[model samples]
Target: MTHSRKILVTGADGFIGSHLTEALVRQGHDVKAFVLYNSFNTWGWLDQCAADIRGHFEVFSGDIRDPYGVRKAMEDCDRVLHLAALIAIPYSYHSPDTYVDTNIKGTLNVLQAARDLGVSKLVHTSTSEVYGTARYVPIDEKHPLQGQSPYSASKIGADQMALSFYRSFETPVSIIRPFNTYGPRQSARAIIPTVITQIASGKESIQLGSLHPTRDFNYIEDTVRGFIAMLESSNSIGEEINIGSNYEINIGDTVSMIAELMNRSVNIVSSDDRKRPEKSEVERLWADHSKAKNLLGWEPLYSGTEGLRKGLEKTIEWFTKPENLSRYKADLYNI
Candidate 1:
């Protein structure tokens, strides 16, 4: 019953998007990858994937903020997976203007182009950070959105714009909100990569921020599966679905587990630079993924510990290579 349709994946060079591109190719779908434009023409994590997998993707380099480029990328495509955005919360603090331009306006450009192209489906990526600190446990779609930081604020604007297109113009869009996706090829700005890299580098002390904040971490593959599931399920249109593992763990506990698995005894020191602003910090996040399960027949396949082990192993392996480790700025705080 699979349609022989061309799928356009924006941000296909990113962590989740790269994984999604591989998944789609494995499922026998034609993939058009819209990578971010750069002078060096880099494809980010997409470069790390196997050459055969890379061969399967038709890559087009362009900026998401450009409407003409976005429209050209969507040409002859049946579905669009919009994953491009400025996601670094810490960087957003210093440059909120960039977030608004990229997260909000970029999404608007994609939506308008998709509507014009009459794409069969559009899946817009969102983050659980939009919900900010949990007012209640097991946050559902009904939870109030608090823009605890500039990054979340921009995402809120983007999500609202996507949903509005769905409601007002029947744009056939689904907002896929994923909670803390962690795995291979993730930027060092993420906690998992940061911890794994520091440990792999033979550091006796690992620097981190507030470790009490809890998050529901979905493995990258499962998060990408949720995106594909939304595309395949007609019921997902006009609906915002949460894709998460539903299990929450404190950052302190997560680091401890990694330490044990890595067989390294390291002291964790809280660095002021690593901590989010007191008012901006999100204390807890646990997703209510029932909507995704019932609607898209999807749920996280990897448990927290299991996913962590896999992520750490892969990250450690990658960072062990000098070439890969050189890509990360382990000496400085990313945001």
Candidate 2:
């Protein structure tokens, strides 16, 4: 991947995508941002990016599900970072069809376009949710995939599709699987943001779901760096790599830590509406990132505790701002 190569980043208007787009621009790459088209003509998080960064991006608003639109965005681009998907777990339960269409079919569109365009490499985004409850600790790339929820199931289909493309058409593809990522610009549907918004909104009791499930979290920056490392590493092609801190902290402990950092002693109230179906919940996830280290030469720069602390502080600062905080409906339960 040369610094001068043209790159197309699908889902560039998203949280991690926006951060990655900014990072790519900062590194002097020519970026074409493939933002989801909407009736309001909104650019999502990319609208909040700094002007200088935005200036460097060639913004293309279209649906990833559209093959023509996807191909148009990939034209003349040397690489494609496909990140567009329907990611909400609860929503996936109610709208599984939408998840299949976006996560699975949308990925197919990107793969076909990348193959047709002869892109040098295609970095396919994946989530650790596909590993389910983790049959063993420190889940690695070879762990059996369990579709605990519709969202993860769709991602499984998409991941297999990318790999199939690589095998059948010799498409250069690298699957980048990131565990729980939280930070500024994250939606309130996520636990970290939900907790932060409730606390920042001056709620005395934090409403949440099950607290015993542990997760391996990676800060937004560290996750973005993992993507770049995978992109630059020639050995990463046709490989699946895990990007995480290799540390696990239960939700209960994470909330306590957040409360401590915010200097607030909020009561925790488990809500039935917030809980996942017993069979659908993932109980544990701890990433084994040895593959990432040995192959891509990538390691998380932030330890679990330090990363959570700094990420929470930055997230708190962002949510405390009236303009930013107002975007969230702290009083309502986000799906």
TM-score of 1: 0.96
Q: State the lDDT of candidate 1 residue by residue for 1-335, as single tens digits.
A: 23337999998899888989999998889999999999987888888887778687799999998999998888878899999998999999899998998999999999998888788899999999999999998999999999999999999999999999999889999999999998777888999888878887788998899999998988788898899899999999999899988889999998988888788988999999989989999999999999999999997888667865676566567666888777888766776
Q: Can you write out model 2's per-residue Cα lDDT over 134-166, one digit (the tens) per residue?
A: 899899999999999999999999999999999
What's the lDDT for all of these models?
0.89, 0.92
Cα misplacement distance, residue 4 of candidate 2 (Å): 7.8
- Clash pairs detected, candidate 1: none
Provide the lowest-lDDT 10-residue window in model 1.
307-316
Clashing pairs in 2: none
Model 2 Cα shift for residue 75 (angstroms): 1.0
